[model samples]
Target chain A: MIDNPYYSHEFHGDYELVSIGRLDLEEGGSIPDCRLAYTTFGTLNEARDNAVLVTTWFSGTHQIWRDQYIGDGHALDPAKYFVVVVDQIGSGLSTSPHNASGDNAAISMSKFPHVRIGDDVVAQERLLREHLGIETLHAVVGGSMGAQQTYEWAVRFPEKVKRAAPIAGTAQVTPHDVLFSRSLVEAITSDPGFAGGEYTSNAEVVAGLERHARIWAVMGFSTEFWKQEVWRALEFDSKEAFLEGFLQPYFTVMDPNDLICMAWKWQRGDVARHTGGDLDAALGRITARTFVMPISEDMFFPPRDCRAEQERIKNSEFRVVDDVLGHLGLFAVAPTYMPQIDAHLGELLDGPA
Target chain B: MIDNPYYSHEFHGDYELVSIGRLDLEEGGSIPDCRLAYTTFGTLNEARDNAVLVTTWFSGTHQIWRDQYIGDGHALDPAKYFVVVVDQIGSGLSTSPHNASGDNAAISMSKFPHVRIGDDVVAQERLLREHLGIETLHAVVGGSMGAQQTYEWAVRFPEKVKRAAPIAGTAQVTPHDVLFSRSLVEAITSDPGFAGGEYTSNAEVVAGLERHARIWAVMGFSTEFWKQEVWRALEFDSKEAFLEGFLQPYFTVMDPNDLICMAWKWQRGDVARHTGGDLDAALGRITARTFVMPISEDMFFPPRDCRAEQERIKNSEFRVVDDVLGHLGLFAVAPTYMPQIDAHLGELLDGPA
Candidate 1:
């Protein structure tokens, strides 16, 4: 068998953590001796009040945001502000489907602890409180699933968040979102060798992962991207080459167990339920000034889903990204919406509210 | 069990066949007996020469085009042209996965008989010759997969088609199309009880069907559509109600076997291969003055794909539909492109060269 170049390798950080802590989920499960993957790009101020909490999206590790935004004078000006990005549980870096010990690793949607978006936010909050001693965050920012975390942070600990930017994200899963996520889970669970997620090896799980990737590709990008990237536009030395470049990237980059875990988490995300199903009550708790930016072409967290949340939150204002890149327009067509992002971030950072 | 209103007791004139014939699939498999299920409205003129052949899209029985387009002064104009709409093999109205007998039924992708776009055209040609006794057609028109079939008519039997309008469709499946189709197939096959097409009892293909529908929904509409349809502007009573409307439609409206068969046939479609893999050769064979209209947001069949085909054809013009409705826009937003459709169709019906 030929070596596949598309497969991503595991990365262990060079620096060791000073201390590690376990977070007991409300649903009666504990992430025992949880190892948090964290990274910093710039210097922290004397007061540490300029710290911003960056949340990761679905299928994304802490490394993604760190690579993109944690640079000098950028949206996250690491030189001026301390940026702390935490990997959510179920993601590869944190306690996850891959590295969880004993009974935890074998868990799935049915057996897995009921982890709401608030649970993820709570875990990150505990990490911040214990490790970095962050009593308050200057800003909380995220996209997609990350945006759900941003919403949770504002509502769960209103006093902690001064400003919030939830980009191409939603407050709750729409019926369509549930439908999409259900399809993804079904794609994984239906795999013959999945054996209800108790496979001794990873082969069947990877097939499910690949299926998950294809589903994501369709929903993630705009029709424009698919038009250009797939079908008629595909050109290569051979069909094998085309499959390698286009299809393999979906399955090869991520672990199979990770796909199942993230999709399970994604389906259960709810800010209102986190506040005990009182949508109005949750909205009233958010004291932070919120800027909800949903890309017009976003397939996953549609602009209108975000708009519905904008209508609920007290100090929330919404903007629609008109780029053709769909859900990924927040990242891929960043240039088109960068000015808006910069404007919102600048207004909050500079203005004395 | 909930009342599935989607499973209507057949529409008016539904399943009523107007003509019957044999569609000789020259590629080794003979559909010994083929019966076309069609509905016609308005009057046919004295001259049999004023005949229009309307093709149907995948999963869209003959009714959509015949019922919707075959009105007086409409794009099809049944008053002037004697319309002949034949249901393609493996599609609902004709021989298919649901009602198929002998070797044709229960066919999987690997087991499915190789039926190309040319097979559709040839079958329709036989329908026109043996049953209708029409020497020539005024125009051949269809949308999406229908357009694919229409394109086939123009090239397969050049002398038969005087004009052709293949709308909201591509010249061929793009790399993205292949990827999506491959994923859909995997989703169905991965179902444990699928039992490699051997599972006759207690098999749950609904999960696979649901996955296929979700993918189809993602591809059919833009993000704006989901926001409008599923989120902010939804009319459904609950999230479950909305999902039933959004996700269940595919499973309820189409059989799992039918969806797979349609997808398989779609994957096998290659008009370029009909003329020995030389696209120019296929286009060269088309003596019909062709008009190709591709929807702007139709990622499945982008305007560029249509233009490439138009460029190959001897006498062909291309029109671009600027609508966010995506592939479905051809039918959903028909008013915008109808004038162009009418003009091209009228010119073709004038007379044979």
Candidate 2:
């Protein structure tokens, strides 16, 4: 494993591992002895039926969902239901390009294989059924890339999921977004320090990572966020202050190979592949009661795109939530963000399958 | 100039230059022995009162406004008025870092002086009065940075201009746009070939230039443009083709230093400097009849921003033109783009001042 102190469990708290073993990928190839990084909250009853699965977004780990949205009095109260947060493969904490050591060294760094949204669902399904001994999920919830996987869980294994919520993400990626993600991939490879994915450490590729972060700064936040000087809430007096203090430092510590891997997959996230590019047919397979939640000011996945996908799923509700931070609102930057997610999720979890 | 065939008169057609001597700058220092590159259509009448000034946007020369909006049937009819299209300083064709040799070598490459929107207007005014022997302008028309210059012309020399039209631009760039332009700067500087703005040639910094191009691809076009597959109209099969065939080659030929110099000025394009940061006061100085024309889909300078500024101009009308290509519609990518501009300009040019 790459000895990076920044993303250790110390930085994100504790997590456990579950080996699903030699899982095959949707895009051809297999992750030999693949292990999934995850953490659970509350307890699984004797009936093994009160389990909920939470997937992480890009660059996020199992710890993101903890404390912020899974506490008592919240919709995802761990005291009431067993909440399992799974770190998606290639997410650094899992079998990422940064940490594929020992029996997994063959897929390390540049040697890693391509992954799809479907591959993450397949592996997580194994972790739940084989390792944790759960047959059906009470609900599956996530935001951004996690949301892409949420739709996969709903459509691929329709009968197994009781409810699903895919927030700030679309089932089939838009042409605009596919091009947007390409910019991130180009930023990494263009860096000379990348050295064709043979860099000794993340520090070597700091220039490209900083470029990646700056690109995100332009698209992640809503126009209103910058117009109203919302960075003041984040303690930044000027936009330059936010660029230097918050943005540049955030991505500089990340491994570019892993990020490029995610970007490639993110660009290819199409559940419509199941029905040969028929998005309506793919969404029609979703049997679970669902909430298609999109942040109203989100630049990446606008509300109009989310509403179109929501119309395809029979039992789905179109819920538009406010978040001035736009796509980055998935971080719960808005004070109302978590509370709103709780209300929508609480209702779906309590309703019929 | 820099021996760049792409920007030569053979490519852009006929143009001329006029020396305005040593001109003072808005942000301190000066472009010593500065020259303004320009092209004129039709004829200067004996009266010279029918003269109009057309400013070019960033990366544009004196050719863009020709044929598209300055023909016999269009709004800027050369037969009716002497149309002078002037390329702004640091725009490669007009005393930019790339070609700043001979007496202008002191401000060449990395040693180029910082510029503001007001500087261009001041230089253009001197060219009109000292060289061209014109005391007043019938109207001033421009888009993007060109728009920024148009506002400067109206407010700085209120008595000199009879009409002004600032299209797809803002008097003061928003905080969101400031951060967006920073990404472009970062992309170039982060490339190893940039060598701290000391690159041997534009060809050497192709990687950085391509990254610069890709960033533009994401923000230049509107969501509807991508959703509707607008590139198909341009004969590109996909967005990736548009990236490689168009965007990359478009920027890779230009000197990085010149591009960065333009970007710096573009980010700081605030006419509010005239009234100590009071936008209302700066715009209130406009005695010319004006049309604050913003593209309906322009992401960079949205209509709402233009509307806000129009309210401040005593005789200004807010005109929103639809263009699916967004900020890039300044290139006339939308079929309706030039017509809408012609309609608005015709009204302002024909009306009483």
Candidate 3:
């Protein structure tokens, strides 16, 4: 395990490497002895009936969603709920570009196995069932990319989950989102040093990766944010100072390989495939009570998209979070929206529909 | 004049090197006989009563708005008005980093002549009265960067212009716009080949500049645009083909030097003295019956910002143009908006209020 001294005691989670036998990739391929990185907080209880699966946003680790909402008296309170946080495939902690099982890890787009968000849900299911002996889940909660995983879980295992909260996410990535995410992936893979993703000796494409991060940052924030929150208050001694202070920090936080893989996965997200291309039909398969929270300024999965998903699901509630934070608002300004998220969780966790 | 064989017309526009006489730099400094590139369309009537000054957008040549709007029966029609287009100082066509009159362009943050949008208006006023025998303008019109010029005209030459139409723009760029533009300039100037803007070899940061263009293309268009208009329909036989077909085309349209200068000008855009620090007081100077037409999906200048400007100007009218085209909508889909802009121009051109 990687040592992190700054690790907070606020999240006393347990980590484990579970062998899930093999990964059956979408390209008619498979990888044997696939090990997954996962963490669990709270207690499973005697009946193994209180498990809540938590997912994370893009560039987030299992530590992310776990720390924010898993303590006592919180929505996924460790005192009562057994919360499982699985690092999704392609996220550095899990099966990822940085840690391929074999030489194939360095494979190019043509050779790399196609792993969808559904594959992530499938792999997580195996970990839960085989390792934890949990046959049912009280809920699945996640935001952004993790929210996507939550949507996949509801459709993929209708009876397994009793409730779900897919916050600030969508049922399908709109064509525009697909374009943006794909461009990010292209930025990484197309760099000359990429060498078909097999140039292990060359330094990674820091420039391309930084470009991707910069583009992502633009989409993540609302125009009003920079205008009102930042702008006037911030001044740099030089233009270079401004970029180093504001731009480079975001790039440093992300790993290039992981960014490429996850962006591809995000673009491939589609709940309709689980129900044979009928989105409404896929939503119908969701037996869980769902709270679909859409941020007011999230242009990607806007309130309109959330309302559509809510309309399709029989037991779904559409709660539009009003904030200028845009898509990142759910996390960056979580404190403002958490109360509303918790209130709905309280209603669902209290009783059956 | 650069010859264009495609149109089969020798570009008859006259190019002149004008001495702005001098610039008393913003930081209590001065530069003398500052040269600038300028071009004029239409005949300056004997009375010089029909002179209409047109301002160019960021990276825009004296063409586009010059050819598009300065013709017969159009708004700012040269048939009734002598049209003048001023190339911003830093552009390659003018006395910039590319071709300074004496020493290299004063680019030092301190040596950098703090030329605001108001400065451009003031400079053009000097050129007009001294060289063209024109003391007043029938109107001043611009889009994007040119819109900044239009705003400056109202602020600096409020009595000189009878009317003004600033399209798809705002009175002030949002902080996000400033940051993004600043980032692009950094990308260009940071290239190792830049050598403090004096390198003889090709720019080392050419790739970064290309990346900047790609990012700008994405930002300037609406989400629906990438989805429906551009990327979706593009089918490439290979990744290399896709990059060339889609990506390279965008970077090719704008030159790196031009892009750098335009972006710098954009960051420096302020109708009033940024140093003076009283934004509202400066906005109070616009006396023209201004028509501010902001496109709803314009990522650069949202309609709400236009509304804010309208509220600030004493004699301004606000018109919101809704289109999925974003910032480019006013330029690309000009037909829908042109009629409305022309209607407003009709009232202004008919006479002064």
Per-model CA lDDT versus the true structure: 0.66, 0.86, 0.68
On TM-score, the leading prediction is 2
Q: In candidate 3, how many Å is residue A261 off?
A: 1.8
- Interface RMSD of each candidate, angstroms, one decimal: 2.8, 1.3, 3.7
**Candidate 1 lDDT, tens digit per residue, A213-249?**
6676666765566555423334555544644575556
Cα misplacement distance, residue A24 of candidate 1 (Å): 5.9
How would you encode candidate 3's per-residue C-alpha lDDT over B50-145 as one tens digit per residue? 877777777655756655655667766767778888877655455544444354345422134545566666677888898888898888877888
Better of 1 and 3 by lDDT: 3
Our tally of clashes for model 2 stands at 0
Q: What DockQ do you compute for every candidate structure?
A: 0.36, 0.72, 0.31
Clash pairs, candidate 1, are A230-B174, A230-B175, A230-B176, A231-B174, A231-B175, A231-B176, A232-B174, A297-A326, A298-A326, A298-A327
TM-score of 1: 0.77
Considering lDDT, where higher is better, how would the candidates rank from best to worst? 2, 3, 1
Task: Tell how far residue A329 is off in model 2, in angstroms.
Answer: 1.1
Q: Chain B, model 1, TM-score against the native?
A: 0.83
- When just chain B is superposed on the true chain B, each candidate scores a TM-score of 0.83, 0.97, 0.82
- Look at candidate 2 and tell me the lDDT of residue A216: 86
Worst 10 residues of 3 chain B by lDDT: B1-10
Q: Model 2 fnat?
A: 0.77
CA error at residue A214 for candidate 3, angstroms? 3.9
